[model samples]
Target: MDDVRLSLREWLILKDIESALRRGRRIGGLLRTPRRSIWLPTAVGLLVAASGFLMVAGIRTSDPAVIWAFAAVWPFALLQAFRLLCRWTTPHGISVKASR
Candidate 1:
């Protein structure tokens, strides 16, 4: 790296590119962060399944309260699913511990 000389303008541009990459990585990490937790995903999965059951019951009986209950649970389930999807879409990589 020392063998290569960059002009002041080029150095600034390189620094900008590096910062942009760092910011992008941080955002990606935040988006995929739910996978790092155990209970969150488990709860989301349970909620999704329960919501499905609720919807079926509401449909079979044509009950207003049960339909409303389904409406309430469905949004949360969808949000959690979206969060979970982020982790699934993230590419796996070789992770290493940082040196002390």
Candidate 2:
């Protein structure tokens, strides 16, 4: 995370927020507005579904391509499964910490 750099717009936004708060204006509520994420959910959904299909196909056949696909996909699928399980058992709106 420390290696990551903010883009120009993000840096400007942070600066603006800091300046606003310094002037004693109530500007924090502007952050609660949801920004549009047009493709993120759809992309993740597709990736997970493809991973599941690969895992199942690899287990059912001996094709080299299927084996390669499974190798690439299984770890992501397993991690996603664990995340989903945690979300299901944990209380709503509480974020779970993943171990390093």
Candidate 3:
């Protein structure tokens, strides 16, 4: 029974270490990818642009309250565009580039 308990503890510790190592490797890989970081910003920009266009085209709704809501959300599109532009201009080796 004692031996069994010892082995179980050892197994658990090994599993923990393995999981930690895998997480570390994943983080390292993320750091290595130059385009990973910019995906969110690009998506946000597209969403904003789409929403703004919808508002302008009167496709969203004619209600003044709804138009105001769309207008309020318009800045996110500009923010996303700025983020994408920055990511594109940043050097490849930098952390910012890795995320984009």
Output the number of the lDDT-best candidate.
1
How far off is model 1, as Cα RMSD?
11.4
Total backbone collisions for each predicted model: 0, 0, 6
lDDT of 3 by residue, 1-100 (tens): 6655548889899888766765795565544535556567759867777787768766545777767767777777777777777777877756632443
- Model 2 residue 42 lDDT score: 54
Between candidates 2 and 3, which one is better according to lDDT?
3
| Each prediction's whole-model lDDT (CA) | 0.79, 0.67, 0.69
lDDT of 2 by residue, 2-85 (tens): 899999999999998777775663444333343434454455577788988887888888788998987887677667666656
What candidate 2 gets wrong by more than 4 Å, as runs, is 1-32, 77-100
Rank list by lDDT: 1, 3, 2
Model 1, 1-100: lDDT tens digits are 8799999999999988766765795444433323366776898889999999999999999999999999999999999889778766766652223644
Clashing pairs in 3: 35-100, 36-99, 36-100, 37-99, 37-100, 38-100
Instruction: Report residue 62 deviation for candidate 3 (angstroms).
Output: 4.2
- Candidate 1 achieves a global lDDT of 0.79
Top candidate, metric TM-score? 1
Instruction: Record all residue pairs in model 2 with backbone atoms less than 3 Å apart, i.e. clashing.
Output: none
- Please report the TM-score between candidate 1 and the true structure: 0.54
Error of 1 at 91 (Å): 4.1
